[model samples]
Target chain A: MRSGAAVLVEALRQEKVDLLFAYPGGSVIPIFDALYDAPDIKLILPRHEQGGGHMADGYARACGRVGVVIATSGPGATNLVTALATANFDSVPLVAITGQVKTKLIGNDAFQEADITGITRPVTKHNFLVRNVDELGHCLTAAFHIARTGRPGPVLVDIPVDVSMAKTDVPLPTEVHLAGYRPHVEGNLRQIRIAAEAINQAQRPVIYAGGGIIISGASDLLRQLAEKSNCPVTTTLMGLGCFPGRSPLSLGMLGMHGTFYANYAIMESDLVVALGARFDDRITGDVTKFAPGARIIHVDIDPASISKNIKVDIPVVGDARLVLEKLVELVHFVERRDWLARIEGWKKKHPLTYSSGGLRPQYVIEQLDEAAPDDAIICTEVGQNQMWTAQYYKFKIPRTFVSSGGLGTMGYGLPAAIGAQLACPGRRVIDVAGDGSIQMNIQELATAVQNKLPVVVCILNNGHLGMVRQWQQLFYKSRYSGTILEGNPDFVKLAEAYGALGRRVTEAKDVRGALDEALASGRTYVLDFVVEPEENVFPMVPAGEAIDRMIGGMT
Target chain B: MTESKQVISAVVENRPGVLAHISGLFASRGYNIDSLAVGETENPLYSRITVVARGDEAILEQIRKQLAKVIDVIRVTELSGQNFVERDLMLIKVNAPAAKRGEILELAEVFEGKIVDIGVKHIMIEISGPEQKIEAFVELVRPYGIHELVRTGRVAMLRGVSGRPARAAESGEEKKSKN
Candidate 1:
């Protein structure tokens, strides 16, 4: 017989989880104690539960594996709520093992008791509460299976303290038997044929790929389908890097803050093959006017995602990679010179541009793109920095760009960078963060320093919530209410205090040098680049307006 | 695409938090559950949940799809347009003075309600019928000063179905055609 915590560790071993991002607390002492004896799984303690949760999410996104995070009951589990929601929105596979109070004291308001399972129901894909040690192994196995399977998202397992301490001899289940949980992997053959015919016949076809392509590891398949059909490809922000960003056929991104040519191409296209991409409001602009002349073929794993926003002409529900494999085989080559020429004209007329002066964020991103290694993974905090990185940085490979796309979580970058670095030890990891967003989870700097993960965080320090300020400037007559980041800490000193390398670069010429030096430091480094404050992202579609109605970026 | 009441029934794993998961999905998606009822099915491991919601065709499609996506939900069937039978159970307490006792009993007999309990000045009646009938009975008893009323939302099943109820999967094609 073994303790419940020992069985939990054994279950983790069975799942081949080598790295555990966890925070210790009162309810989880038994599990922590078990970890003391278990040397195979490395425990990287995070300063906060939320940071640890993001780390797990980042690890999952970086490597195609289920990330695991553990936290204690009550406040510790509650702290992970934001991270769970973020991962859920992005569909990242993560298993969060949280400690709960003893079963008998669960509803009696015992010390450190929390209804964590209740709190996380809507955010997580699934969750469990382990009532006994006999079922602990099964729950853990099920949690991991649910988290990593089709349409991957976070799953939480709350193990009561007494359950963890109880003795049990039941072996962990190797396979899950969930009758209600089978994901549709192979799409209907008729639907695939219909989609292929639509693709083959269209004069101007565009492939609008999203993060699902990367999640399903269908980037290569996506490229094949796009190339075979001679289609121009555009990606959403999360879908960046799933296709070669610098390719001639690439339309950088679509939706709000997308490239002028990409948006114009999508609007003008006769066929829009949406692969693993949802037509989000940010991308669709005014839904009634979106893709006015186009017949849409949407391919996704989730049936619900199809025709949820924009009406899909051909809906194929299956794994993206599997569907693309079949689609590439069926789709025939077609060339329309007039369509390509029109897109090229738009690209030349309204290229993504910024006024080149005073340490612009776009300039900084371009410099980082140029200076970083080809395979370096770039994580980003939300707001202007995220938009800038999406706009300026050319991600050549899949899994190289990571950001909180769905939830737009601000503090996601630093911890995510750490997780990415851990996942890809040989690759350089950098967090391109805005000053306001970086401060939200700055405490994770300690996690980076202690782990000796050489993650670089380049803060585009504008001393304000730049994105909100831009919206205020454009829509609210530049009142800038509560957008200013007053009394910001000196980031360089903050890095020094955390025993990490720090640099403050104020000039455009110095940006590349700082990035190079920081990448080579072999220590957690912080680069504070004081970028232009009032700069706004361009080719912007004001909310609820048509995609073609641009506010700026007309060269 | 006008808004109408939609009845959705799902077979789900009989687990601790399955109800919460289903209800939470509805609440988070901004779909109001007009009525909801859950009970164990013939199989002990599974429970049947019947939910009535008000939405247009698009909203109804979304609700069905979202409900099917939940891990615990085994199958989802929309019973609104199909030939189905639905009943809601209600236990209502009303003032039963000596003078009004005969009238109340007469009204109960008309509605096929059974007098479950009787107090000195109150009568407890149990009635099971379609939602409209329940509402009608409640309105009729209101003049008698209803003391308390509780209902077990609604439970529905398709008529002449032996194996399994027809799934809402066919509606996907219907939705596409309408679009």
Candidate 2:
């Protein structure tokens, strides 16, 4: 006979989870007791549940495996809400296990009792509340299956105290069977053929890639199709590394903060091959005017995402890698020399640039790129710093650029860097963070120091929520209401207090040296670069304007 | 184009929070559900849900795709424009004065409805029919002042020997519209 907690551990073993990020609390002692004896699964305890969740999210994004996290009931589960929502928005596959009150005390406001399944329902792709020991085996298996399959997202399995303590003899299921859950993996051949025909016939075409390319491991197929068709590619924020930044066919990222040439190419193209990317509002500013002349062929695994935002001429639904492989087979080669020249002209005329100032964010990012290894993983918190990393750093590898894309959660970088560092033991992991956003979960510094992860936290200390301040500067007549960080703590001192190396750089010339020092440090390091607060992300398509209607940049 | 009321039905696994997940998807998107019904299907492990929603064709199409994305949902079908049988059950109570009682009884009988209960000041009638017929009956009895009303949303079955999978008929609309 095996206990319910033992069944859960066996299920985790079957799923091949080598590590777990967790925070122990009242209701999860039984599960923790089971984990204590299982030396195969190393449990990394974070300072808080939120940190644990983001760590798991980062681990999943870096390794392409379903990351696991364990938290207790009540407040412990509630703390995971932001990270869960962030993972959901970014389509990261995660299995979050939360402790619950005993089945008898579930709804009676028992100690540490919270409706984790109900609380996490909206954020999670799917959730389960295990009420009995018999249901534990299938429930855990189903959670893992649902998490890692078809447009992946976080899933939660809540185990009650009594259920975990109950004993059962039923072995773990070999295969999960959910009567309602079946995901379509193969691309429909007919739709794929039609898409290929459209690609073959088009002269001025642009390939728009999104995060799904990375999730489905379709970067190689994407590069192959782009090279075959001679089509320039523009990726969304989540799809940075799908195409090499230095490739001639690459136009960098496309969105509000996209490069001028990339945005113009999308608007001017006759055919847009949108692969694995949702035409989000941020990407398609002024939806009515977005790609006005293009016949969009949108390929996504989720049918709902196909035409939800923009109307498409051809809709191919399947896994990104599988669909791209099919397209590579059916698509004919074409050389659009004229289109390439036009894009090159636009790129040369309106290049991404920043006026010289004291420690520009862009310059800092460029130096960080230079100081770090080619295979280093760069995680970022949301804001101006994140955009700068996306703009300046040249990512040539998949799963190297991890950030909160859909939810844009602040304070995601540090913990995520910890996860990435743990996942890749010898590689240098860095967190490009905004001063305003880093403080949101800065307490995770303790977790890093305690675990001896050599992650470098590069803080762009602008003393303001730089993105919002920029928006206020441009559209709100510089009113700057509640955007300024008036009494920010000294980040270097904060880092030192956490028992880590800390340094500050205010001059542009010193940026590289600071980064080098931090990278060379064998322990966790925090480098605060005080940047020009007013520097805005350029080639920006203002809200309610077409992507081509960019307002700022060199003429 | 004017909005049309569409009937959507889905087969889902009988699991906890599945209903909430389905309903929450609509609510979060600001799509109002005009009426809804849920009950166990022929299979003990599966349940069927029907939602009557009014929106333009584009919104309705989005709703179908989004509902189908739910993991617990086995299938989602829009039973509109196809040969199908649909029924709605409504229990409506109306104030009936001495002179208005006869007219109300006559109106209910014309719609093939029955007076299930009668109180001193009101009458309760149960009606079962298509949405249009129910609407017509409700309109005729409006003069009597409806005191209370409840409806079971549309439940539908396709015509005999013409069963088509949800995904098959769905592609027809996409091909017809070229979108």
DockQ of each: 0.33, 0.33
lDDT of each: 0.91, 0.89
Residue pairs in candidate 2 whose N, alpha carbon or C atoms collide under 3 angstroms: none
Lowest-sum lDDT 10-residue window in model 1 chain A: A175-184
Q: Over the stretch A408-521, how does candidate 1's per-residue lDDT look in tens digits?
A: 999999999988888999999999999999999999999999999999999999988999999999999999999999999999999999999999999988888888899999
For candidate 1, give the docking quality class from DockQ.
acceptable
- Model 2: per-residue lDDT, tens digit, A1-555? 989989989999999998999899878899999999999999999988999999999999998999999999999999999999999999999999999988888899998888888778889988888888998898899989989998899999999888888999988996886655667778889999999999999989999999999999999999999998889999999999989999999999998999999999999999999998999888999988988889999998888888888988999888999998889998878878899999999989888887885778899999988899988999999989899999999999999999999999999999999998888889999999998899988999998999999999999998889999999999999999999999999888989999999999999988888888889988899999888878888868888788888877666
Write one digit per residue (lDDT tens) for candidate 1, span B1-179.
69899999888888888998888888878997799999997767778999999988888999999988888788888998899999999999999999999999999999999999999999999999999999999999899999999999999998884544334322221111100
iRMS per model in Å: 8.0, 7.9
Best by TM-score: 2
Alpha-carbon TM-score of each model against the true structure: 0.96, 0.96
Provide the interface RMSD of candidate 2 in angstroms, 1 decimal place: 7.9
